[model samples]
Target: MEKKSMKGYIYLMPALIVILLFTAYPLIRAFLMSFYEDYNMISGEYSRIGLGNYKDLFGDKDFTKALRNTSIYVVFVVPCSIALSLLIAVLLNSNIKCQGLFQTIFFLPYVTSVIAIGLVWSWIFNSNYGLLNIILSWFGIDKVQWLNKPKYALPSLIIFSVWKSMAFDILIFLAGLQTIPKDLYNASRVDSTPRWRVFWKITVPGIAPMISYAFIMGFISAFKVYNEVFSLWGGKAGPANSAITVVYYIYDKFYNSHNYGLASAAAVILFLIILVLTIVQRMMGRKK
Candidate 1:
């Protein structure tokens, strides 16, 4: 038995080593850096400053704006993505022709490179010659500067994000829809149940777990959104900091400002937020 256990441990050692080296080491370093003041460039001298970095972060208006923008983006994008994905999944799962083609088309965005998606969307949202404004012009509407305008910039990012994220949620919902037994729908029909009522009572409950999972995943993804915003807004926070997100703020602090201490503090705060939100979502899911 001891020999067998030793062999098992040997087999697991590589993965354990990789996790320790990559995940654990960086996390420990970041946590330690959060308490430091200035980062040494030439001599590598990092002095301890207790909670001063965190205090600076809290006092920073840009950080606060980034947090607020991120929160709003999450609030809008998460539910919209999940609900639209679920609807699309239901449509695809029904008695429709070319179901496989539809699935491929919907899932394509999820597989596409973020940079490519951003570039394509940036062209589409261009104020004068873009496809969106062209269509709006057909209806006698004026051009709108999507990336340049503070009010429209965040919403534009959210729209693109929802489009990009919908594919994954659709696949998840499709899988859940398949797991729901056909008998439930047939039985409901035999009992003279209305179609809508059958869906509300049977289909909704059957896919509740998938819905919860999609919601949590979408929420987390929306919170961590950075690449799209960066690509669209020329790597700066969007106009007037409208499209600035938590992760983007952290990246700016760490790389642009060379403020590793405050960046790590921001990361710690983000981790706590994600942890609490995920726990609350799981608890609510269990109750349902």
Candidate 2:
């Protein structure tokens, strides 16, 4: 048995070493470097700054905005996407005609390139010539700025995010729904259970695990949003930094400003947030 275990470990050695060399080493190095002042990205020289980097982040307005905007994005996007996807999954699971075609259409956004998604949506969201405003024009209402105004920028992001993120969750929910024994649903119908009760008591519990997984993954994705904003806003955040997120904060500090120490500190903070949230998600899943 021990020899067999040894052979198994040897089989895993290459992958384990790759993970250690890339992920673990960089993580440890960044954590240690976070205590120093901005390390010269070019020359690799820095001074010990203690908690100066973190302190600066707390005092910085853009950093605070990034945190708030990320929180708002996660809070709105995660649940809304999950709920919408769940509804779609249920509908698709029913005895509807052309389900395959409908499913493919819905899942296309998830498989499409992020750059393409952003570009296509940009035209639709254009303040002046966009189809959205064109439709509003028919109603005698003035065009509402979508991406170019701080007031509407975040919501525009949320809409685009939900549209994209819902596809994967829908697929997961559909798979989970299939795993549930059809006899249970049939029995509920035979007993004359109301539609809502059948859904709550049977369907909801049946898909609870899928919902848990979706929520956890969705929350993580939503919290770390960057590429969406970057692509949509052409490498900048939305108007007035409305779509700025913590990852983007780190990107600006490390890549743009060359503030390595502050970026590392921010990365550590992000890691902690994700770790805590994942743990909480696991606890809730176990409780349920």
Question: How do all models score by TM-score?
Answer: 0.93, 0.93
lDDT of all the models against the reference? 0.87, 0.89
**Which candidate achieves the best lDDT against the true structure?**
2
lDDT by residue (1-288, candidate 2, tens digit) is 344446787889999999999999999978977888757767777876588888998999999999999999999999999999998999899889999999899899898988888887888899899988899899999989998999899998898899999999999999999998999988987999998898899899999999999989998878889888987888889888888899999999888988889899999999999999899898987887
Model 1 per-residue lDDT tens digits across residues 196-252: 897789878888889989888888878899999978877878888877889999999
Model 1 reaches what TM-score against the true structure?
0.93
